[model samples]
Every structure is written in C-alpha cells, then in structure tokens.
Target: MAGIGPAPILFNEFFQMFMRCMPPNGWPVNSKIAVGNSGGPDSTCLLFLLQKLLTDLRSKTMARQSIPTSVVSLSVNHNLQEASHSMAARSAANAAAMGIEHLTLDIPWGTPPFSDKPVASQSMEQVAREARYHVIFDGMARTGAHSVAFGHHADDQVETSLMRLARGTTELGAGGMRRCRRWGMGTGDVEGGLGWVGHHGLDRWIIRPLLDVRKDRILATCEEHQLDYVNDPTNFQPEITLRNAIRQMLTLQEEGKDMVLSLLIITQSALSGLPQHISGSLEKIKVAAADLQETTMDLEGGLHQLHGAVKVLSSRLEDVDNEVTFHLKNLTLPSPPSTLILSSHALPAIVDPTVRLALVLRVMRYVSFHPWGSLRADGNRRRTSIQRIIDTLWQSDGAPPFTAGGGVLWQPAIFSAKKRLRVGTQCLGRRLQLGERFAWMASRLPAVPYNMLDTAILPSKLDIDVTERLASATSRGDDFLEVLFDCRFLVRFDLSQIPEELVEALRKSQETGVNVRIKPHTKYYWPKVVLRKPSCVDIAYATLMDNGQIDTFGHAPWVTMKYIRLLDAT
Candidate 1:
C-alpha cells in the first residue's frame, strides 16, 4: 500500500471534514453558482477541485441529483497597479481554457472625497473589500446565481479572530464569520434589519467552502495542478494595514518560536469550547431577563424588573470575571420598556454656541436616544432646571458630552405610554391590497384555487393603478383595504378597524394575542403573534412549492427550518 505525502493527505483530510459537515444533503442541486477567483493560489485550487468534483459526479449514475454546474469566475481588477488588468486577463484566459464561464470587472481605486486620506492610511483593506464584494455580488445577480462561493481558508479565519481580539470587539464580533447567512441586495441602510451594511441590491449568497482547509493545502493543490497565480504586492506592505502586520508576526512566530502549530492547537481548543460558553452565558442572561421584567436595565441605576413583576436584581461586577460581567452589564431587562433610558440633557451646556452645537451633535451620536426633547418635556420647573444647567455648562465651557454606547431618550409624552415607548422612527403597518384586476385574475386561475395563492404573490401581480391607490390611501388616510387569509380569503378591512377580528383569530388559533411593535417614525410594524401551529412549516412549504412542482425538494428527503429571533432594544 503506497502512502500519500503530507500535502495530499492534508487535502483529503480537509475534504473529508467538509463532506461530513456539509448540510448532509449534498450541494444545492439546481441553482446558478458563482465562484470568486482572484487569480490567487487559494481560489485557483478551489476552482480546480470544484470542476473535478462536478465532472466526476456527472459521470456517476447514482448522482442523478447532482447540480448542473456552470462555473463563472469573477475577477475584480482594483487598478491599484498597472499590472492588475493584465493579471485579470491571465485569469480570464485560464478560466476560458478550462471551458468555465469568466468575467473581469474593473473598479477605479480611490478614497471617497469625504475620506480623502490615502487608501493605506484610511483603512484601505476594509474599503477595498467593500468595493470587491460590491462587484462580486453585482456579477452574481447579473448571472442570476443563487450562491457565490469564496476561498477563505483556516488561516484567514485565524487572522480575522486575531484582528477582532486586537481591536477589543464584542464577543459577537470575535466569534468570527458564520458559515452561512442571508445577504440583502440594496445600497442604503436597510430600515429594519442589520448586518453587512451597504448596498442591498448587490447582495448575493456568499459561502466559504474552503474555510476548513488550511492555506498550505491550497498552495500545494495549486502546485499539483500547475496553476500560475499572481501574488498581491499590497500584502507585503507592512506599514499599512494590520493584516500585513499580523502576517509578519505569524512569519516571525513560525521562524523563531514554532508558534504556528501551537497557535493552531490553541485556536482549535478555543473553537471547541466556544459554543458551550456562548450557550451558558445566554441562558444566564435569559434567566436574569425573566427576573428583571425589562429587556434592559440601567447599569448605573442598579434596578431590575422581574417579568411583568418589577423586582430589584443586583450583583457586584467583582463577583464575576471582567469578560462575563461586561456582557451581563450590556444585557437589558427583557420585557416592556426594553431599552435602558438615560437622561443627559441636565448636563451643563457650553457657553460658546459653536462648542454647544458640537457637544449636542456628539451627544446625539453617542446616546442611543435623543436627550434634547427630554429637557423640554419636563414641566416648567423641571425645564427651567435643565435650562439652568445648560446655561452654566455653556458659561463654564464644561467638558464635552459624555460617551456611552447604548441608551434611550426620555420624553414626557413618549414615555407616558404603558406598553409602548417612543423611539426614533415608529413603523406603521401598511396593508397590502389586491386590486380589482388582481382579484379577478386570482379568482380565475387554472387548476390552482384562488385561495391557494400566497398573499406575497400579490406584489408581482399588482397593477400600477392598484399600487398608486394603495400608496395614496396609506399616505393620505388612516383607513385602507388589506387582504388577510385564514382557511379562505378574509375580506379587505382597515387594520385599526379590525382589532376585534384579529383578536378573535388569535383566540381561535389558541395562541397569545398579537402586538404591533413599532420602531419610531418608520412606516412598518412587525406583528408578533402566537399561532396555533408552528408557522415554519407553512412558510417553508409555501416557499418550496411556489418555485414549481417539487418532486423531492433537493437531496434531503425532509426539510428543517431554524428560527432565531433577536430582540430590538430601542
């Protein structure tokens, strides 16, 4: 029996590891796919492996459900150097030779006018990454690809975790990149959600298929395949970017201390215990929330509410380790008044109007909520008291506004509501209406019952007239028609006018009542309603069935849905 060398053995081991961890349903069988190839060793190796795997699978009679693979290689020419374009051309040629689809996108390199500093000095690494992803996602959409895979190896993950640790990031950030996540494709900040902020329209499904593989294996694979790759010169410049510094440090560790293996071992150890650490911390926080009633509590106030029952829960920071206590301090009470409200307008205002303006702006950015209105809302006497403090601060040129990460504003009328608190933007529910034409078409579908169609499909079928009318009604009047479905088509009814109907539905569904959760002035509300049955089945079936006849939805004979809800602390 012949024994394979370290390189081949490592590659096979990593591939086996991936096979075991893969969703256990094989790769997505029928969706457009894009591969990010930067003419680098890692990506070249990945492309070769994917092509071989796809080809081999196609030859196997048992692999009837193998995805029809059409590989598209995307190269982003950052134009940082004159040779960038030539390198991209070489990559494109290589891809063409392999009979794989290829595209080269050229992006002009420069800092935005507002940030006129050199790219290197102005966090150029992050800036370039944003631009590169923007291009890749745009290409993915143009090709109508469902998933885009990248070649991020174990070394990259180590580097990322190290960087986050160095920067004193929160635990969530330090946890490193997720294996899979939803990508939104739009430019502006998504009004309701967070994560990967920037354009959402260019969003494409991104995956790191090589994350578990080592960089050495990648380089070895490239060598075995006789693939030529371009070395990025910017990576060598240590004066610029922390990544370069980290790479230099890692090189030093390898040469001087044999630290690479030790670091890897330590990282693996950390990874093994990370899940349990996170789980235990979250469980304790949940119990604390149940006892405190509020989702958040003031760190300074030492006040905690117990569920709907208000109670005082306090613990000294010295009792727990700094790492654990720091997180617990950030946790808010879990019930109503979810936000930790802080009042800061009482601070003395600067005497210089310019200074005062700057201070106000800085405060606004620092505090989770505005304090200016809080001062005005207090009765005449309290308002006078706040004004006096402002005048004194202004006259004395007091220190700049205090810095705090998260806190909510307090106003007289806003905080008066029992269950609701006024935050920045409150979202109003807008009822989606199916117009006369849509209703008529929906009522007359062939073979498919009118009620079987999802209400979500109305957006595509809605005519201009219906859209205009809905928009006008939502904008000008409080009452508007909405289509709701139970076993059948529920008639159009005003959202405010149908409280009784919604309550009755909730009762019949054997669930808790629904609540309209608002977010400041935003014109949308997330309705949290308990249903008689798990909505996941309905949602999953609706999505899977909507695409067409699902013979057996993918390789897995069964489907599973995982839901994780993050509370919004205003």
Candidate 2:
C-alpha cells in the first residue's frame, strides 16, 4: 500500500505519540482503534502511517516493542456531495487493499433535528460533523474500538480556535479541540475530566496524533506515497463557512508560520494542563461525596466525628440494589425520605469555589446517572444553566426546595430549628410523586419482567440471557421501553409507583384493522391491578389464539405502545 515512505524520524515520532495514547491502565488486550478516513489527503496520510506503525510493531521480535493494535478504517457517507458515497466506497476499498478492516456507514446528513435553520440554508459542515461523529461513535461501539483517531492536524486546531473565537465562545474554545477526550453516544458534548460513564466506558479518548504535524507535510507525504485522496474543493470556499475562511486566511500568511505554530502549541498545552489545573479542587468534593446518607421528617441525628455537625452523607442511599445508589454508606440518615442532608457548614471547610462547583456537578451526575457529556444538543447551554443553578442554590436562604439543574431540585437544611442548618440534596423528581413504588426518574425508562403470574412463560425467542440484558438496558423507572430485536416492540412500562400527575401520555395507533393488544407489567410492580380478572398474560394468550401472535400494547389509560411484535421462539 506504499509507493513512498514518510520521513523516518517524523513518522517514528508521531507513531510513538499515538502509541502513548493507548490507556496504560487495564483495557481489552485486543483494543481496536477506529481511524477516520475521509478519502482526503490529511486522513489518508494518518491512516497509511498508522497502518505502517501497527505492521512494524507486530512484526518486531522484541517483546517490549511487540504492540498489537487492532485497527479499522471507518468511512462515513454523509450524502453531502454527489460522489460522497463513491468516496466512502473507495475508502473501504483502500482499506481492503491494505489488508486492514473497514466499516462504511450511510448517515442521513440532511439538516439535523438539532438544527434551528431551514434545511436548504443550514450549515452543511456543522450538520455533517455531528452526523460523522455519531456514526464514528456507533461504529466504535459495534466494533469495540477503544478510541477514535482523527486526522486533524495543527491547521485544523488553528481553524477551530479562530472559528470559535469569531463566534465568541468560552475559555474552552481558546484551547481549540482537546488532544484526548471522551465522546459519548447520543451525547454531543465531549468530556476532558476524570472518570468514564458509559456502560463499558466506551465514551473515551478522541486522539489527534497529527496535532503537532503541519498540513503541508501531511499533503506532501500523501502525494509522495501516491495515496488515493481527493482535495475537497469546499475547503477553498472561505465565504461559505467560517472554517473555510480561516483556512483561506492561513494560506496568505507565509511569514506567520511560526506564530501560527506557536498558537497551536499554546492551545495544545492549555487543554492538556487542565487536569492538573483542577486536581486540587476535587479533594473537598471527594470528601462530601463520601459523606452522603439518607434522612426524614421531625429529623434526628446522633453523630461523632470532625466538627460534630450532622451529615446527610452522600455515601448513603435508600435502594442499595440500584446501580445509582451503589456508593452510599448508609440507607437512612437524619434527612427527609428521598433526600440526603449534610451540615450546611460542610462546604465552608473547603474555600475553593471551583471545588464546590465540581462537587455539586459530581453529585448531580451521580444522582442523574448522566456523565459529563450526556446533555443532548443543548449541552453547553444546559451546563451553563447547571452552573447557574448551583450558584443560586449556594446563595439561597436554604429553606424551600428549589429547582436547580433542569432535572434536579435542591433543598437546604432548615436553619435555627435544627440547632443549626444542614445542606440537603433532595431528588425533586421523587418528591413530586409523593408516594410511589419507584423514583420518578426511573419511570421515564421503565422495564418490568414479562412474567405477570406464576404460569406466564416468556416466549422462547427472548433468550433468558439476552432478555436479562435487554431488561437491564431499559431504565426501571422510564416510561418507554424499546426492545430492538427479533421480538420487536415498544412499550410504556407501568408506572403504578409514580404519582398520577407525572404520568406519560399513552400512544394510540393510526393504522386501522391492525391487530393491537395491551400487555401488562410484571406482577410484582402492579400486583393488585394485574391480579384482577384478565391479566396481561391472559390478553396475550387471547391475542395469540386470534391473530397467531402473542404481542400486545400496554392496556392502561397512561400506557402508550408502538410496534408490538411477540415472536414465539419455541
């Protein structure tokens, strides 16, 4: 696959840099890297060079140098240009010729649902970027790839910085793109801090090996190697897009090479230094996280420790079995039900404001089961609001329960009455429900077992193991459960536990004469209602006899169902 070799020293340096990005800690031995290939010079250069690096590493006899990096080239077709699909095909073909694995995705690249403007006039580049990353993340998920390698060079960094600056972004914008970070699926935001949140922590490292490489060297290498790549004409159309405009400006600055290169280095350093920058800020937050506990009405507390102030320890939780509550130290505390309270003086011990905000963000994330980047299209906006809410809570009189983050509500421990005030962390979703079987958040993605009675047997097609995995995939409290396989169906899992006011609107079918059925929840969740004469199992059996299919929708005033199909595996 090579007609020419990249400069030995230059290639070796960048190769080592990419190798270092591999997690030093435990990772799958067969860790795969998904290299984005756009059939363009920059991407082609990175791809071929990576191919050479892996080949050399594996071919070596020395144990120390024998690195086995499973690699795959991903070509995403956004249907932007007329020949875009053909370009993607060529990318896959090139990977085939080089004996590397390849994956091609046909993404719908029209105006994104996240977009505000009309389809015809919307920014194709922005929409394409989002679509491309979504495909990349999904491909990584399916292939078990650990990190995504991009061909973005120093020039790309310059362009991103300039574009964000022109649009008036924050300090993060000044740092340009992160050298290594985590990108979660369906979550548009990228996270640079500690910890991983996805089921397998797949939302990880966005490596830019070419961050230090110049655009000119990349083009030269690709040409010298006779690599198949196309120069995107869109890059020269500066007036059409901000990034293109930055690129055009860079071409006119022959004397400004050092300055541009320096700026890139500065941006890279700024991003990489952030972890160390905030390292000291989380100490107090960590302490608070470890201090959580549950509580109640006409509160009482007996404590012996530093300061003697009460702690609604973050370490305590009501449902110990729930994954979200796995870290709690006590099930019950001196606070209200569905709430954890700490001495109001708890945060004052740590004076650093950054640490306080970080701690609050951590608590919110832990409670919400949402990682740093889980916010949807409005990620930045939501984060800003979250920060604002934290600030407001910090300043409030510490009495009434106030809504903080869009999804969370906070209540400060009552002062004077308690001998002193205690800070409270209450799940607002829970309080509104008053008395329920599960938390309000859980109702959003509900999943109850198929068995409603002792005799009810799940259809054989839903393998016991797969079914368990599928059931776990659905949120226990979430209202909608979509099973995306052979026994295809969408359901509104029963919410007898949730308050009547927070109920989800049920789904109604538009197609007439299509046999529709209403299924029931697990017998344990709604024992009384399901115990009545006709159970969900009975209805399903009746449907099976009539239409030869056991599938049915949830039969409830609040239950909405779609695409119900129950296949009999046996």
Candidate 3:
C-alpha cells in the first residue's frame, strides 16, 4: 500500500485475484508465514502485500480479528555474490520499517548436513537453491511458521515452462511451478510421493500469492509505493544460465506482443483432455480397490472402476490446485508380487487397450512426482524406456511383476483370494538420517523428489538417534510422543505409564497375539494393520509380511524404550 504505484481500484482488483493461489480460508488458525525476502522488487512487494493483507484482515470482521497473523521476512545470504550481505542488510532495514522481523541466514558449506556440494563447473543455481532452502527450513523451525511464501509470478511460470522444455522434461516437469505444496522430511515427501505431512506445522507448505500477477504490474506497484529493491544484474545476461536465457528471450518476444500469455495458454492446451475435477473419482477407485476379493470381486467390475479413476486423475494433474498423493497398505497375498497370476481368461470387453496404457502413466503419476522419470515417452512413438515398461504391463493377459520409480511395484496379486492388482512401493530400504538434510525439498514443498540416502550398515543406523530423542522427550512426561521415521510413517510412541487394564488386555492378547501397525508407514498404509506383539523377536521381525518375495526397505519404527517393550506386548 505504501509503495504500490497502481490506482487504488486497480491494485485492489489485482491483489484480490492474486490471493486466490492459496486462499486464506484453508488455514484454521492465525499463522505466522516466513517470506523468502531477497530484497528484490517481487519479494519486497510480497512482504508489503502480506503486511497490508494481515492488517486489512484484522480490520475486516470479528472472525478475522480474533486470529492474529504476522509475517517474518527471511533473507538467505548464499555469499555467492559480493552484494549478498548488503542485500540482506537492505531487506532487514525494509522489514524493520514495516515492523516485520527480519532474519538473515548464512549459507554453510561442508559435508554431512549438505549434499551435492558445488563444484566450479557445475551450475551454482542448484547450490544456491540448496543453501537458500536450508536456511528457509531453519527459519521456519526457529520461528514456528507453518507456511513459507515466495515471490514467483506469472512471468516466472513462462520462463519455468520454457526452461523445462529446453532441458527435455517429462509431463510432470512441463506442468509448471506449483502454487502450494507440502515438502519436508516426514511421510516420504523428500523421498517421493509429494513429501510429508507435519501436523505441528513445522514448514509444511510453500505458498505463492503473487502467481496471478505479472512482472510489469509488480514493478509498477513498487514504483508507486517508492519501495527500494536491488536488481540482479546476472538476469540481464542470459548466457550465464538457461533460466536467464529463457527469461531474457521471453522478455524480448513480449516487447510488442503478449507472448507470455500465449505460452501459458499453450501450456494449458498441452495438458490435454478436458480439465477433470477430483471430487469423487479417486474415492470411488479407492473404495473399490479396498474391497477387492478373489472369490467375490467381479474382475470386470473392478477393472471398470480402476480405469475410470486413472482417467480422471490423468486429466486433473494439470490442475495443480488440486492436491494428489498416494499411500499403500501392507497386505498379504497368496503369491509373491514378482509373479502374475490372473484368473480372467480374456481382457474385459468394456475396458479398452488405450485405457490400460493410460492407466500405467496415470497411476504412476498419482504415486510419483516423476512418473516418467525425466524421460519423454509416447505409446505411439518409438518406444521410450517407460513406454516399453508400460507396453509390457498391458500384455496379452496382463503384465508381469515390474518395479519403477521410488521402488514402485506392480504386483498382480490375482489369485482366488484376491483378484486385484496390488501396487505399492517395493521392499527396498531407504536409509535416512533424521538430523541431516532433505534439502532440495524446502522451496518445492509437497511435490518432492524421489532420491534419499541409502545406508549400508545395520537398519537402525538411521533411526537409532531418533529413538534416543523420542526416549528423552518421553522421559519429560509427555503423554503420547508422535514422530515420523524416514519420511515413511508418522509413528506415535506410548510414553505414559502403561495402564493396568491395558496391561491385562496385553496379557490376554499375549495368549493368541494381536495385530500391530507399529511402523508409521504401515499405520498410514494399512489402517487395519494391527500386529500381535508376543515377543521382542516377533516385534522386531514384524514387517510388510511379504511372501519372502520382497525385502524390507529398512523402514522401521522409531519409538521410545517403553514402546519398544510394547512392541513385544501382544
């Protein structure tokens, strides 16, 4: 409001539309958001806009006034350029003028906490991004903020899409930057499948309110308000980086025409198919899949539901506003997932061949951030690697067992007991250290990358320290300690003194054994996965219960000492 150059009505109209990216309605409480303030015109405008929005909301109604929202500006000093420190100082002064607290995070260079250390020849962009997100995560933790806001706008989207096309991207890559996403350690987010779900609101979202605005308007607003910001001279020199080149080229093209808008329209066109709503399609498929049976499940009926869900999902991946994620429940089958055994003699008359091919890509998209794994594939074209796999998946009768991104598996558990296809992450372990870093995920929250560290030592090497921490926290008389293990599960440890009644219940169960969903991922995937903890050995051994076909992905529970004993309790 102070520095915006547009007329009051024009500015109000534009700002209102921009706020739609991540509506304030979804938030249940007054949240403190951390802004990635670079002291640039875009971010500077964002900080000012948030300040105005919070103030305006406070004055609007009783409901809004009750919830107190504040902004904390964090300047990430990568130390890459000589002006980095000065930029941080500039941001701090601006934030102080607006009565918002400002913090500067210095980039750290070393081993364990950081990976992919920058080299001279390698691009510094990724390194700077890593350092920036590291500080952003640190800032979020220190300030107890739930959402981190960035300054990406409409023009950035144009550049991003073009850059992805230049780099040879898959379908997911071409979809452009997300407005809101959950990213971080818990719930396998950093490993894959749209990151974690942190209930405590320790950096769960990256919100972009300025996505609806264009760069020219943004600069105009800054000019009107008399706001001072630094320009990155490197952006003008396109040859320095691919992004810069694309950005410069787009600027030149848009000199006399609306090239950015045209590209975005074309991008939408490329997403293809009518935009599908996600209201009921996925639920229908999940309900049917959950009820699949070998003796009772009508094979034709089940495929019908599965195919429909895949179609709807594929159509809606373009609508980044709709959140899509997947999880698997550990269930036992009559045969190993590596083998395919179908009772159906022929393909269903109603389900077409095209549906089968689309299902593989669509289903893979549902569970993975990169379904095609950075490679372009077309069922109609010279077979790409993923296409070859998909082609095999829809063989004459049905495809054989196959594995893909993030240890994804396609197990045709099609015996008499279960006439359904069981798809889930394979048994390969993903060893992760709690305190280290799942760094790249900070900016792209929720839509996370798949690769995480795989430790070769004992499985406990990753979770042991987490165990100790939970133990220490539990000793402080915490009632129930809930913690996530390796982004796989959200596990809760029973720390309170065991009740005598429950002890008796355990004693009774000890006679027969009770089903336990001890691990966090298991609890998440197998809602009914209750295991019988009859002994320490059984408790330790309780896993996905694979038919000796798959191996554990080193995913284990992180619990306190008392809960470890509970694992032994039936």
> When superposed on Cα atoms, how far off is each prediction in RMSD?
21.2, 16.9, 16.1
TM-scores of the candidates are: 0.46, 0.52, 0.60
lDDT of 3 at 57: 70
Candidate 3 local Cα displacement, residue 231, angstroms: 1.3
Q: Across residues 433-522, which tens digit of lDDT does each residue of candidate 2 receive?
A: 222211111010113233543445533322111222223433355544332211122334444432232221111112221122233333
Off by over 4 Å in 1: 1-5, 9-29, 61-68, 109-118, 184-203, 257-570
lDDT of 1 by residue, 1-570 (tens): 997643732444544543432332345666556788887777777776766666665677765364535678888887766677877987787677677889887664443311222244435665666567667776776777766677777666555544554543323333344444334322222221211222233123556667655677788777777877877776665445665554544554545544444334323442233233332332233233333221242111221111111111111111122333232233222222112322223223223332332232222222222111121111111323333333533332223222211121322112222344332222112222332000000001112223433322332111011223233444465564532211011123243432344335434442432222101110111111111233432212111121122222222222111111111110
lDDT of 3 at 283: 22
- Comparison by TM-score, 2 against 3, better one: 3
State the local distance difference test value for candidate 2: 0.44
Model 3: per-residue lDDT, tens digit, 451-570? 221112323312332333334554576677664433223345554543333334344553555433333222112111123344543233223333422122233332332110000000
lDDT for each of the candidates?
Answer: 0.40, 0.44, 0.46
- What would the C-alpha RMSD of candidate 1 be, to one decimal place? 21.2
Q: Of the candidates numbered 1 and 3, which has the greater lDDT value?
A: 3
